[model samples]
Target chain A: MAKVLMKGNEAIGAAAIQAGCKYFFGYPITPQNELPEYMSKELPKNDGVFVQAESEVAAINMVYGAAGCGVRVMTSSSSPGIALKQEGITYIAGAELPCVIVNIVRGGPGLGGIQPAQSDYFQSTRGGGNGDYKLLVLAPANLQEMVDMVQEAFDMADYYRNPVMVVGDGMIGQMMEPIEFRTPVKRELPSKEGWATTGTKGNRKPHIINSLFLDPQGLEDHNIRLQKKYKTMKENEARYEAYNMENAEIVLAAYGTTSRICKNAIDKLKEEGINIGLIRPQTLWPFPEKAFQEIPETVKAALTVEMSEGQMIDDVRLALNGKIPTEFYGRSGGMIPTPDAIIDKIKEMLGGLK
Target chain B: MLNDKRIRIIVGHYGSGKTEFAVNYAMKLIEQESNVALADLDVVNVYFRSREKAKMMTEKGIKVISSAIGHDANLDLPAISAGIFAPLQDETCQTILDVGGDATGARVLAQFKQIINFMGYDMFLVVNANREETQTKEGVLRHIEEIERQTGFKITGLINNTHLLRETTLEEVLKGQALVKSVSDETNIPIKYISAIEKVAQTIPSDVDGEIMPIKMYMREEWM
Candidate 1:
């Protein structure tokens, strides 16, 4: 219950330990490198496994190996590194393994740059690696959310029997902000005796965890079955945050760092008598499209701002359709606009509306 | 008014040759026996930037103000100072603040704006296309407006320093000029100068009688 100035990476590492995630395998990368180091020290003290794999691919498979045994496990890396792990992530999804993967995303398109960017919104939600699969991806805006959701990710992974990911970028990884750690939820981890690949417990059948269903129809059925779970997630788990939305004439839609900036813009614009609000998505996978749909008719426009050229903006425009004129403001690759800069756009657009 | 030591806010998009602009600007000013300095204020970008050129700036006596060498490449990079704020107020000839790619990165400028304005300093925001964020006129205007808001300072004009590092083509400069013209018409701010990585400063079109920055300090010292 103490307020500590911890980076988002360190907070997630601590939360993982609290959540009884006894295994972590990750490759070292910038912004989030503190994570592996923190876990290296924290996990072993709690009698956990912290394996530093040679590559991102190796790390996620290590996660697969650990999750197959029904012990809590996780892995993390940045954007380019995550691309390398997608193959193993696909396997983790296909096998219906419960694990947590953290992506402290950096800019990209191929080792683009090491700045905070939400360019991975599409990659995390729309399946970056392969197959018709959905990874329960959570976007935490602050250090507190980073810790809360890392713990929540474990619970969600177990509840749904699927993989979960914490998709953030450099801002979340490196920024030092105040955080309050969650009381480690002590739950009896699900029983592994039935199918977990642990040694035979009292003459039980030999257990195996593999995604090799050779029959095409059988694979189709499995994928369709997975689709049902995704449907459930989409229906029940979409979450977002709104500020001063009741009296606003326009809405600023953003996620991650831009979303936080949008909050500042909304407050300053509101002070100047321009009614504005913010919609910040917490779950990027089960994206809170319904939240926008619930906006009142008094609200006319939504401006989608992101660090990418237009990844999340496209999603916003799709969510609103023609109900309102959705506009977009973006600074792609590795650019971040000042708070005043975003407010200026809202001011310009508000004048246009007038 | 020839105080080169005042803070020169050199703003630009990523990969738009802002680092090189700071380099040549410092080099030219240094050779002129001006007490010049530079500060790497670009936080939201990593690699192939002005930080890579830190050693060279020091060799030429260009004091580069920055926080924690090899620190996080981010927007909130701590505002570092070498006590140059005092000297630049009256004595020094030029001091350049090589700010980050877009508005947020330039928001760091807000921290120092009031002081600089009070001390009679000038600011120039750099524009480039080959960069992802500032590829359009609208994007450029948004960035310009954002920087102005954050720093409480206005960019008098634009510098179309559009180049692809070593592989910059002449055509990109021409297209960049066209983009600058659109911005000029909309905001009424003249296109100050369009610099090339090769240090080529061509004749300004009739409407633009902007000053030329005829220096490009890369691997050598020969003028093309």
Candidate 2:
């Protein structure tokens, strides 16, 4: 297929349909509204269903119901909208349902502003809802990666029988970029026949989908089982890109739109004879801690940059584990850190190390 | 040079570079016309609106009118400024109305249909063949019909402003020109301008239907 320029939100909608997602339920929100709008228009043409529910809460529950039917189902929203969907998301996670949830993050503890920000790192990675559960979170830095990850998110959700979240900032959702849909490698997915709540005739037993467990022991066992799944994901699914790691004086840790900015800064620093590397995590939940080990011995310090006031820095600290002196630089309230600002931060951190 | 119409309303598919073209057109018009006003009538898209460049345009003496709230207001509320009426009413000002993208975006123009039609404004549908919705001649026609239906106004001109951001090439521009040219022939809507980045604009042959409008990418950041 020829490459076509697509807005990130519309590309995600197209990717979901191409991935055989037959059901979509979402509400309108800035930055990510285009996804649902695109789905509402195109899904029906492909013999699928698109529902604009009354609210994000209602939309996520609709996703829960659709996923229980063993169909590829998804819902998307921005920050506050995603927060509204938390209860439903936890239910979907606890029920071990396969669905894709996308959060095109904007700033806020509460309706911060419609511009891009990476503030939802904790909400997505650390479980916003009540549970001993984990969502397989994929954070894509650009549109092409976002498209690829969104399609793959459906497969990973089904294979593991858990919800997978593809998180990007508002910039990623709003920007236009050239992208081509490629066929993803098929996974050895478990058949949904045995577990799904598809109506059974007299020939088979009826399947139930529920997150509630009255018995304490039953809930404990369920929690343990979910933890085991998360452990497997951590071992197998953690992904990151280690750019210019061959020999480096400083390393930058960032993701999503911030990572792209970091790459530009790294290139500029290289021109000035300053060797800096970057560790961009593609998967945020299975936090890609393993990539930190690849940091060169010449590295003087590690700096974590974000569009928020350092939420992902916690994960970076845990991943590095005192291997190197870790520092943080960030901008919040919908402010994006420019390449020059990032370079200055790197230089400042290097100077401090001296 | 653009059309002689006093009011030029720019409409197109989302990300078809309408805002970029509108900004460039206003700047170009300011060189000849003393009173130039750039009204951002876009209520659909929150980001990348021409109003975001209000300060710079204001510094350059172009009257920048955006959301009803204010020029610096970053809220996504669908409130357009009533101040737009002044420029439309002003006989001397060359007003560029940068409408939002798609039929949804073009619907805003309907609110001004009476004044626009009465004043004899020129509405141009900017076409980018690289955009998924406007990739084919049929798609472009569908877009035009929808916009015309929404606004109850006929498209008088076509602006081929196709691009893939900074990665735009001469071949890409030519491909877009071919698509828009076919649409022009069928619709009889004259090709008003073939807008491209300065580098690609220089490479386009004179045989192309529209006068080449070499534009600077003011809307996008350097790294974008």
Candidate 3:
């Protein structure tokens, strides 16, 4: 297939359909509205279902209901809307149902303006909803990755029987770039016959798709099983990209839109004889902490740059384990830090280390 | 300048390929003459607007007025740049106003009604017969009516720019041209151009009624 120019949100939506997601439920939210809008128009034509739910709360519940029926389903929203869907998300997690959730994150802490922001890092990577549950979050920096990740997310969700989040921001959601959709891969998945609630057939036992285990012991057993699955995810699914780390004295840690900026800053620093490298965590959950170990012994420090108030910095700190000094710089409330700004912050941090 | 209008404003449905047409049209204007200014009056849409190509346009000496805050920023807090008015007031510059999509987006045009009226501008409705919303002559007419009613600017001409993303064929292009031609016949609006992909436009028979504009599909889907 030939490459086409597409907005990130629209490409992600098409990618979801291409991955065999037949049901979509979402609410309108800026920076991510195009996803729902595209699905609303395109999904039905493909014999897929698209419901513009009354609210974010309703939309997520719809996702839960559809996923329980063994159909591939998805729901997307921005920050505040995602916050509303968290309770449903936790319920979906607890039930061990597979579904794809996309959060084209925006500035937040409470409706904090609509430009791109990575403030949702802790909310996404850590359990935002109440419970010991984790979403396999994929952070894509460009439109092509945005398209690829959403398609891969559906498979990951079914593979683990857990929700997979394709995390991006307004920059990833609204930007237009050339992308070619790769041919859909045939992924092996667990048969839905055993678990899906497809209504009672002849001699088989009815499948009960519910998170409620009234008995404390039963709930504990379920939680333990879920934990075991998460352990497997942690062991296998952590993904990261390294750039210019051949011989670096400084490492920059970032993800999604901020990661792209860091890459540019790293190139600019290289021209100035400053060997700055970057470690971009493609998956926010099960973060590629191992990449930090690859930071050369010559490296004196690591700087975490973000569009939030240093949320990902904690992960960098945890990854490095104080073997080397780690510092943070960021801008929040929809303010995007430019490459030059990142370079200055890197210089300041390196100056301090020296 | 198909209709000899100094300021050509392109309007259409959300996915009607308006931005792509506007970009190609702006490039054509620049190729023909020097003083060209493209105003990104599309405050309604956050993506795929002419502003995304501002650097390319400006590098070629074409003045561009887009987002005041940041480049390619989808900020909901729309702050229209004041420089948009300079081209409107200037007589020499061949200005192109790329308005946002649909009736609600056309509401932004009301802000420049007074200046546009005083300056005498031409509004062209770009139609994509392939779009689900405007697949027939009735649908096309209804959309045109709705856009005109909302924007309060009667469209002066029609631009047929139908396509199935990058999968468009010569047959589909001709089918779309026929639909838009029916619309032109019914409404008496001049068919300014029938936009076809570069390959299709080259092969279009000379007997085709309107001017054929060979456009590269700048706005496209992932799997072309």
Candidate 4:
């Protein structure tokens, strides 16, 4: 297919449909509204269903219901809206159903602003919902990567029978970029007939989709099973990109929109004879510890940059595990970290190292 | 140069570079016309609105009107300002209404239909062939009809402002021109401007139908 210019939100919507997503349930929210709007228009033409549910809470529950029946389903919203869907998300996670959730994050705590922010790093990677669950969280840095990730998210969700959240800030949702919908890598998906709530013939027993295990032992067993799936995800699905890691004095760790800014800063720093490397995590959940392992011995420090007040830094710290001196620079409430600001922070980190 | 129409209403598919074109068109008009006002009546999109550039345009002496609350506020409320009436009433000030994308966005113009029709405005449908919805001639015509039906206004001109953001090339512009040219021929709506960035605009052949408007991207960031 020919490449076409698209806003990030619409491109994700198109990607979902192309990935054979037949059901969409979402409520309107800025920065991510275009996804629902695009789906509302195009889904029906492809013999799919698009529902503008009454609220974010209702939307996620609808996704749970659809996923229970073994169909590719998705729901999208901004930060505050995603917060409202938390209870349902936890329910879906507990049920071990497959679905895709998109959080085009905006600044928050309480509807902070409609601009882009990486403040939801904790909400996304740490599982905003309840009890012993993990979402396969994919954080894409650009529109093209985002489009590819959305399709892959659906497969990962089904392959593991778990929810996969594709989180990008408002900048990724609103910006325009040229993208092509390439074929996603095929996953060896298990048959849904084994567990789906599809009606059974008289010969077989009925399949029940439920997260409730009233007995403590049953709940513990369920939690144990879920943890094993999450562990497999951590081992097999961790993804990251190492840029300019050849020889570096300082390494910058960032993801999503902030990672793109770091790349720009690294390029500018190179022109000044300052070598700066970057480790950009494509999957936020697993944290891609392998990328940090590749950090050259010459690197003196690591600076984690973000659009929030240092949420992702903790993950970076955990990934590095005291291997290097790590520092942080961030701006919260819709303020983006520019390349110049990143450069200054890198230089400041170098000065402190001296 | 734009036509002598005092009110130039810019409408098109979402992500068709309408906001970018409107900002550039306002700046170009300010060079010739002393009083130029650009009203961002786009209610559909939250980000990338022309109002985001209000401060810069205001400093350049172009009157910028957006939401009633404020231009700087990143609120997505669909509140059109009463201030939009100022330039519409004052014929001396050339007004450009940067309407939101598609038929849904064109519905906002229906509210001002009486004054707009009475004053006689030129509604230009900006076309970007790269946008999936309006990539084909049939798709462009369908949008034209839907927008016309929604606004109860005839689209008098077509602006080929197709681009792939900073990666736009002369070949892309020519491809869009061919698509828009076919639409223009069928609809009999004159192709008013073939808008492109300076580099691509200079390379366009003179045989193209519309005046080549070299636009400096205002709504997009330098790094974007």
Tell me the TM-score for chain B of model 4: 0.97
Tens digit per residue, CA lDDT, model 1, B29-91:
787765776777766644335655668877888776665544233433454554536545645
**Native contacts retained by candidate 1:** 0.05
The TM-score, computed over Cα atoms with residue i paired to residue i, of candidate 3 is: 0.77
For model 3, which pairs clash? none
- What's the lDDT for candidate 3? 0.85
Q: Model 3 Cα RMSD, Å?
A: 6.4
Give Cα-based local distance difference scores for all models. Answer: 0.76, 0.91, 0.85, 0.91
Interface RMSD of every candidate?
18.3, 1.1, 7.5, 1.2
Docking class of 4: medium
What is the lDDT, from 0 to 100, of the residue A119 in candidate 3?
A: 91
> What DockQ does predicted model 1 obtain?
0.04
Considering only chain A, what is the TM-score of each predicted structure?
Answer: 0.96, 0.99, 0.98, 0.98
lDDT of 1 by residue, A55-161 (tens): 88889899999989988999999999998999998898999889999998887889877777888888888887789888998998877888988998898888777
Q: Write the per-residue lDDT of candidate 3 for residues B66-106, one digit (tens) a residue.
A: 77765566666567887888999999889998888788778
The TM-score of candidate 3's chain A against the true chain A comes to 0.98
Lowest summed lDDT window (length 10), candidate 2 chain A = A288-297
Per-residue lDDT over A1-354 for candidate 3, one digit per residue giving the tens place of the 0 to 100 score: 645556678888889999999999999999898899889989999999999999999999999999999999999999999999999999999998899999988888898878779999888988789888989999998878878888888888888889998899887887666577886455788888888988886868888879888999998998999999999999998999998998888898988888888888888789999998889999999999899977888889988989998888998898899989888889888777888888898888878888
Query: Going through the candidates in order, what fraction of the true interface contacts does each contain?
Result: 0.05, 0.68, 0.22, 0.68
Sorted on TM-score, best first, the list reads 2, 4, 3, 1
lDDT of 2 by residue, B151-191 (tens): 99888999998888778899899999899989989999999
Deviation from native of the Cα of residue A110 in model 2, angstroms: 1.3
Give the Å error, residue B31, model 1. 28
The Cα error of candidate 4 at residue A186, in Å, is 1.6
